[model samples]
Target: MIACDNLTKRFGHFTAVDHVSFAVAKGSIFGFLGPNGSGKSTVIRMLCGLLSPSDGHARIAGFDVAREPAAIKPLIGYMSQKFSLYDELTAHENLNFYGRLYGLRGAALRRRYDELVGLTHLAPYLNRRAALLSGGWRQRLAMACSLIHQPSVLFLDEPTAGIDPVARRELWDLLFEFSSQGMTLFVTTHYMDEAERCSQVGYIHLSKLVVCGEPDDLKQLPVVNPPDTRRIDVTCEHVTVGLQAVRQLPGVRTATVFGQSMHLLVEASLSEDFIRTELARVNIPHADIRPIAPSLEDVFVALTNNRNGET
Candidate 1:
């Protein structure tokens, strides 16, 4: 339901977003992933009509961002990083105000208010002031406020930041629930676990999207020598020496030290006997060897680090 063409944004001599282009399918949750200062927020703002692009163009729900911002504004809901709600207003009051802003009134406004309260699990707190709510409650309140008008598209910028893991999971469940009901979500998050939950993810770095695909597809991107395919944990007197010795062994791709132990990534065909023989040659006491699936964090780190080196 969203599309961008060579989108660019600049302030003075620095470009915040550089010729980035991507599309979000209707009813899909598209995760925008990046480190600090990677322009995820800038792009989001531009798409939401809160900011104008310096170059290129974009459309939301088939309306041009620049030429038809007003028509699109009411069709999308935006929840910024900051909690944007009146602290003194009760949960019901806050939604009431937002509903009015969208031209909802009387029974319509009351119905939406009650529906949002129920969806966000804030029914019990309907009479509680926003400021009195805890972080998780405030977050849910903010989300409810954003959806008060039942917009077709939702823009969430780090909505789960600073919340506990359990709260984060609950919030994600809510997002998936909304998505299942046909609401398109455009979210920006630093957490890899959340990124993995998205239907598709765009990995941004240095104002550019380095990769965009499903989480598993991104993970399967070609790695050097298939990532050595094995991990060996060893505890030795000299971890550094053991690492260096492992690096020299055949089939060993990389050896990294983790605390007092070293993790070796070696070819799958290499047997424990061969690894033990290599350790014996270096007089490094060995501990154990096992296989583990590579995580999303591992793939992300590898891609970003490799990109940094290239630059």
Candidate 2:
């Protein structure tokens, strides 16, 4: 239940967000993807009433962000990239403080505190000071504090940044749990895997949203065809030589190394047999050769690099 129409934010002569518009349906996790300094956080702040937009307007749960900011504040919770908890306070104490700020007190505060502690698995460290907690623990505590008031809408700005893979996955699981309970999650993340997990994604580039749709829909956007510009992953001991050879081959448009493997953008006319025969002739020992689906990162790279020619 979130909507924005031509939302724009400017600072003097510079525009941070330019005419970005999108809607988040109830119970959906809408992922906002962008690189550093792409104005994602700026747009999020404007949507949450933390920053007034220089142009246009946003409505959250039916309340106008510009004219009725106070009305919307109580219905939403925001977790910023930075840890927003008292370093000296215990986990329980931090939750209590935020609960009080939201007007929760006595039994109500105690109940919410307990619920959040359990939900975020903070019981074991309830008496631990925030500064003493690990990064992952601190992140969980911050998320718990934000939800203590039980707001219907949650805005998470790079919530999983710098956390370990396991921790990030756990945090995503918690977000999906909240969505299943009818909470709307508007999240901005740098991780393509995380974006793929979202119900829908909005890609921001140069202060504007260049793409918005389901992850698969965005991945399927047509690109310039070398006819055979298919992606194939191959693992070989001689990755450097293999890449060079593949790039020089007819029907092969691009060959790049990804870790220990190689990703080839080849023509559709390049059959599996042809590829195998070429590798065999070169005496290259490949672990595997098969077509691989393009990831969100691949689509993003293609889209952002050559927008003029995209379909």
Candidate 3:
């Protein structure tokens, strides 16, 4: 339902999105991942017809985003990062205002308002001013307003940013329900776990698309799983110290601290004894080492490093 062909965006001498291309199937949840200032939001703006692409084009549900913006506007809904809500307006008022903006009047507006309130469970806070609502409540209000018109596609830019874990999970549950009902979703997030849950994910770096595919397919990329090397997880005390020790080893390709453990990419010839002995020398005597698969994070880090080497 979404397609981009060499979509490029530039501002004077700086390029924000560079010839990026990808496609999102209908009812699919597509996760766009990247670091801050990686042009993730820029691409979303272009796709939503809020910004024009410098070269190439993007289409939504068969309508060109740039050329046929009017036709595409009613077909998509957008929930910005800031939860764009007026502080003085109550939640109920906000919904009614947006519904009217979408041209829903009288019976249709009332029906959509009721449905959104039920879907988001904003009944209790409907009469409360937007400024008084908590971050999670504000997010629900924003999403409800966006869906007031029942658009076929939804674009959410970091929809879970700053929200609590429970709220984040709840939001994803709602998204799943929407996707099940055949609404295409385009979401940008920095959370690796969230990216893993997507049907397809695209990683962007330095204004370029580094990779795009299913999470499992991305993990299988040769660049992520190098020849003659394997990944291992080390559960030990002082993970930072363990990471420093293993990263300096001759055959250890890379080591990154993950929570209370460390994940290391090392040559297949490097045995557990070798790693154990090294950690022992550094006062980390007890270490649990086990073979592990590359995670979505591992895929992105590997691809980003490769891209860095190329430039």
Q: Quick one: how many clashes does candidate 1 have?
A: 0
lDDT of 3 by residue, 64-154 (tens): 9999999999999999999999999999999999999999999989998999999999999999999999999999999999999999999
What's the CA error at residue 98 for candidate 1, in Å? Answer: 0.8
Pairs that collide in candidate 2 are 227-268, 228-266, 228-267, 228-268
Clash number for each model: 0, 4, 0
Ranking by lDDT: 3, 2, 1
Candidate 1 residue spans exceeding 4 A from truth: 224-288
Q: What are the C-alpha RMSDs, in order, of all predicted structures?
A: 3.6, 2.5, 0.7
Candidate 2 on 133-184: residue-level lDDT in tens?
9999999999998998999999999999999999999999999999999999
**Model 1: residue 280 alpha-carbon error in angstroms:** 9.7
Model 2 TM-score, 2 decimals: 0.91
Flag the better candidate by TM-score, 1 or 3. 3
Q: TM per model?
A: 0.85, 0.91, 0.99
**Pairs of residues clashing in candidate 3:** none
Tell me how candidate 2 scores on lDDT. 0.87
